[model samples]
Target chain A: MGNFMEWLDRRFPATQVWNDHMAKYWTPKNFNFWYYFGVLSIVILVLQIVTGIFLTMHYKPDVTLAFASVEYIMRDVPWGWLIRYLHAIGASAFFVVIYLHMFRGLIYGSSREPRELVWLIGCVIYVALMAESFMGYLLPWGNMSYWGAQVIISLFDVIPYVGPALSEWIRGDFVVSDATLNRFFAFHVIAVPLILCVLVFLHIVALHKVGSLNPDGIEIKENKDKGGIPLDGIAFHPYYTVKDTVGVVVFFIIYLGVVFYWPEGGGVLLEKDNFTPANSLQTPPDIVPLWYFTPFYSILRASTADFLVVLGSLTAIAAIATPFIKTKRSNKIAAFVGYGVIAICLFIFDAKWWGVVMMAMAIVVMFLLPWLDKSPVKSIRYRSLPFKIAVTIFVLAFISLGYLGMHPVSALSTIQAQTCTVLYFAFFALMPFYTTWGKTKPVPERLT
Target chain B: MSSNEESSNGDSTNENRSRRRFITGLTSAAWAVSAAYAAVPLVLSMTPSARARNAGAPVEFDFSKLQAGQMVKVEWRGMPVVVLRRTPAMMAGLDEVTELLADPDSADSVQPGYAQNPARADANKNEILVMLSVCTHLGCSPVEKLAVGPDPEMGEDSKGGFFCPCHGSKFDLAGRVYKNVPANKNMVIPPYQYLDENVILIGDDEARNA
Candidate 1:
């Protein structure tokens, strides 16, 4: 029987994927709530993929009839309604979980050194997820799918050549037609799944390779007096599993809270007119994206022209990509300068843009990170005030965006959006100026 | 002693005759249920209740009224199905799609247990084959596109597939839709068991013989 089991194990690959190299892990004590987000993100990704597969069975993809078909699935097909909600809510949970997970990296300096690739891979996964979600949003074939694709693809039109023809080719017919719908369906159901699966594999590979980072910024890798056995680290199973289970439950509560009670996640699900088929003749009354995107879209919507719009768009990209730059160990003075710039960006963002400017500034810090960490902290006792301040700035900016997103006045919304937009870009554009002189630890060799 | 033996013989013969009559009654009872489907329903007013519409329960139809080449709509619960008697051309056209159908043998498609063989409906060139019109792709009603036309967007090789009026997806006459269409499976074919020459009941166990 044992030999049979061994043969079975060899035939299937799960044993290799989950055992030996992966199962041998240690988690430090005092690792905080932030440590759990990475696992939580993984959990949500699996849930989304499973639900998404079931949903594809019932979804329609033609421009003429996608909306009504979704309604049919919701109304008639057995258990289909549940599957649709599971997928929609699952998507929102994915973004929320990832944001927290990203925060964990930001707070603990997990993006530094040997772990930077993990952070970079995480960023790559996030970008791929954004593409996946965008393609998915198009599949429902509602007015938003039509207009959103119209508006977004139109952004591609900003490119110098192959703009109009490219858009025409993309739509397949003169406009978003049956061909476009079917093709987008293919991309959403098949192409994105393949890319996402690959990215996820890489992201986990990077994460496992680095072990984990803790809140104290201390390595739990020291040995006992004999120096043979681990003194602090614990195996990830049974130890962190107990902790992650709690995190999982909390994540589910929030996930269900959004799915069951307020499934729209604030007017995003079943966007009222999205029930209607795509009609180029009429536009949706309010053209907001899913809530996860409103903060960035708000930035885009705030500026009215070509150049400013370009700036706003660039600012948003720069914001999401900032961590890559801010964690570098090369430029202490500039890193410290980046610190001040980040804080000022946040304060000015709150006072001026109502907070978007701060988030944008923080994102600039992220891009500069790979080149910024000149700090030579040899001991674990050194403090990082500038990074702390930068993180604080980021939080303030995030709050500002969320708050202004909820604001009723159109003018105030536009102002808040534009204010954050400028500070956001300025933070990135000004990064080279700041990173030349950041602060750092003295020297570990001469530690007192 | 001789009188007693004669009385006993008389009783044995009477019992054997009674037993034969009972066996004959049981055979006719089974036949009556199925025969009711095959031959009973042409008498319009004598329709069976919903309870009688069991799996492969013979459904009675008045073929007397249905026009050739035209369709008659029937309801089983809330779902709608079309009962059509194919013209010689329609049957000939079905042959054209023999290669395209994922399961030309009707391996996985639903039908009456009695109609297990190829062509699904019991007997070849039969007047009726029941089909559920709902598209397997999301339950949208499929519009019939019987013949090839100038669909500029459809590929040159595109045979007239039922175009989903909702999404411009197309399916052939045999109910085999294209690969890229939203639907993952072909339209459903309901089970129909035939009982008799003119009086056929739909949805019965014609498979009892099989």
Candidate 2:
């Protein structure tokens, strides 16, 4: 086996590559529970792909047959129910892991400075995954899938002259139909998954190049031993690999629990309305997107037509003025102007378009974090008290927005959603100012 | 450097540069043409398919069996078009509720020219109301609450109309949306005309074009 490996190593850099990334690669010894999500995410991605491939064998993409075909998989094919549930639950689990992984980056400031490329790649992967999930949701040919696509696809019609035409092109028809279903299947099964895999690979490669940031915001590479390994670092294979297995086992227990007992994720992972096949003429009384998208969906619903223009102009002004406004006094003046603009726009424009803009800005604002944050320290542990409070409030706002998105729209819920939306953007927009106001603790020279 | 040597060297270099530019331009042009040709089928394939186009063809339904005040739904182009045979009282009720509607004049909404009257029905045929069943807000179907006077869902003082259960949007007998609903516009009146006394055709009301 050693002789064969040596021969293979001469032809390909198999051993060298493995040693570089795994066996000999050094990671921080102080990695905690949050760090487990990154490895768990990879495991979920593989599960989705394997289960998804098996599903495609039994699944029919044609509109008329799609609903029945899924039923067939659930009943007729032997143990096909297990595979379907695995794939369905896997999608939700992927988001769970990904959101935690991204939160880890946020709290630890893993996206700071040298790690920006890794973060950017991860963002791209996230966007691709969203597209993949959306396309996959349509394949079931259920009522929610149909109407959800209809509502989302119609969002393009707000763009003015070319809007209607562009939406028509996307649907390949006047409405969501067989054509849209077929095309979405192609994208979901092949194109997007390929892109997601490539982006994940690139993300890891970039992370490896920069090395990992620890909880204390200390660079382990700065304190290397005589053998070139960091004093506070351990080999990734023997140390972190074993640790991640424990996380994986624990995760699988919960994952299989959902698969066996609560595959629908209590009407969140899979919606109840989705059981009914799509009827284009009769829309469901209330249509809500999957849970993962509810946060942005709530924001979208909060904007009325007139408020949209105000929100748009305000967002534009803030994004543009970010570089120009250097002083705290100027930021305060801009904030006052922003409030005034919001007040005036409420009286004039509609909230419909503004809701779309806000929902989109919710995702777009995340990409600006590496630059938006001007904090002196990297980790939240060392950051000032106010910064921690701000992050906690932001998380609360996000979770609340997500919860609100799942329910029927009401006047009170709309008000609540709007307030949370404001907080969500303010967290990022005011980061440059508030981040600089606080006193940060000194980072340790090495991992404790 | 000698002038003769510099001129010869410059001439050869210019010739080589032009040759390179020519090849580059030629290759780019060929690639552009090929790409355009390749995209033609893809673009054409994206248009509405044969099944989709055929789905939009005019549909005819018999209204003879449709009783007065009864709404009959027929599918045309994959959309539900509701035809209601309004009673004399329902037709009279339309005018009384004009003050309660968002688009009382139907000026901001789409309908055939024949439906421009206060009744929003065909000229001289005010008893028959034809409109798409879809709500203008988010396309949910509005249930008929055609019972006159105070109802549980709509409110007291409600004259029978359609009330969208999804968003609480109300529409009068003439399909004009009530004010302060999530739906801003009146229900769309599809291009429709009576082919005969018993049969009605949707998607081909020539009276508007004429």
Candidate 3:
């Protein structure tokens, strides 16, 4: 056995790579429930890809046949219903895990300084996953799928000059037809999945390079022993592997419950309109996107023509001026200028274009997270009361926006959505000021 | 340090700066060339092929066998186009229901230049009403309620039109959506031309208009 081990080590760096990433890799000892989501995300990703491959075997991409083929998979193929449900439910689960994982990062300041590349790579994975889910949603060829594609594709029409032509080019015709469906299937199955896998690999590689942040947000590596082993760290293989197994078991319990009993998630995960075949002439009355996208959708819906211009100019000025505004006096002046620009834009442009800009900025703001945060401490635990309150408000605002996105648009809901949108942007934009305002707790030398 | 050594150090620093600049320029040029080369296939792939463009070709229908007050559905580019032969009563109903429509003048909606009137029908063929069956509110196909009396869904005093089962949006006999319904705009009128008195070509309006 020793001779074989030596031979294999010469052939491949199997043990060395294992020790670097898993066996001897040091993880913080203070990791809690929030840490499970990172692993859970990987599990869900694997589930989606495996079941997606299985679904491709029985699925047809043609416009006339796609709907029936999905139905056939549900009814005819042996345990095919389970596979389809797993894939469908897995899509929702992926977002659930990813959102929680991101929230964990927010609270722990995992996106700070040394780990900025990891966060950026994770964001890339997020964008790619969204594209993957979107293209996959079209494969069912349901009413919601067809119209959702139509509405989203039409959003490009808001662009000047090349808008209409660009949309036509995207659809491969004047509208969502067989060509659009075929191309989307190719992308969903082959192109996007490949990109997603590559991004996921990069995300993990970047994370390992930076090591994991703990709940205390203290650098464990700074307190290394003579042998260079971190004082507050344990081997990742034995400690975290066993701990993650428990998380996996608990996750599967809830996941299987939804997969078997409530795969539709009460019309949030899978909409009722999606049961019917795609009809180009007939559009379902309420064209709300899937649940994961509702927050941004609500923001998009809130932008009326005049309001759009105001918000657009404000967001543009703030995003552009933030990096350059160095001194406190300049920041104050910039804030005043931002307000003046908003007031000016109210009379300049219409709300329709601004709403589009607002929707885009919601995602774009996340890329600036590492810089926007100005807290002395990395974790929320050590932050002052106001910072904690701000985080709570931001989470609530996000939840409210998501809830508003799922319902029919109305005056009351629209007002709520607009408020939430403002709150959401304010959380990021005001982070530098608010995060530095409060008194911070001193971090301990070691994990308690 | 000796003056000779200092001068050589300055020369080496200059050489390093120029060398670094050269490498940066070369790398940027390589990236630009690669990006331009790669964009060719990607841009070309995005263009609509001849087959896709041809998918919207005009579909012809012979309405000679259709009876008055009857509607038949034809498939055009994977969309359902309804051609209805309106009765005299239905024709009169179109003008009567003008007050209850969201777009009575067809001002806010799209149709060919010749069909941009209250009736939303081709100027030459008023009796034969052709429109895309999609509802403007959300896109469900509204079912025809062509009777002159009350509809269970649209309430009493309801004139003949179409009713969307999904959202209860009502449309008049001329495909104009009712006021205050989920749908806010009238049904779309496809670009169409009369091939002859008895034949119509859906999706082709250029020949007669030109």
lDDT of 2 by residue, A350-378 (tens): 44445555677789889989988888899
Q: How many residue pairs clash per model?
A: 49, 12, 9
> CA lDDT of A149 in candidate 1?
70
* Shift in Å, residue A90, candidate 3: 0.8
TM-score of each: 0.56, 0.87, 0.81
Q: What residue pairs clash in candidate 3, if any at all? A: A282-B139, A283-B138, A283-B139, A283-B140, A304-A351, A305-A350, A305-A351, A305-A352, A306-A351
Q: Can you write out model 1's per-residue Cα lDDT over A16-51, one digit (the tens) per residue?
A: 655533454656656776777778877877887788
Candidate with maximal TM-score: 2
In Å, residue A149's CA in model 3 sits off its true spot by 1.6
Candidate 3 per-residue lDDT, tens place, A180-267, comes to: 9999999999999999889889988998888999999988889999999999989999999999999999999999999999998899
Instruction: Using DockQ as the measure, name the better of candidate 2 and candidate 3.
Output: 2
Interface RMSD of each: 20.8, 3.2, 5.5
DockQ of each: 0.01, 0.33, 0.21
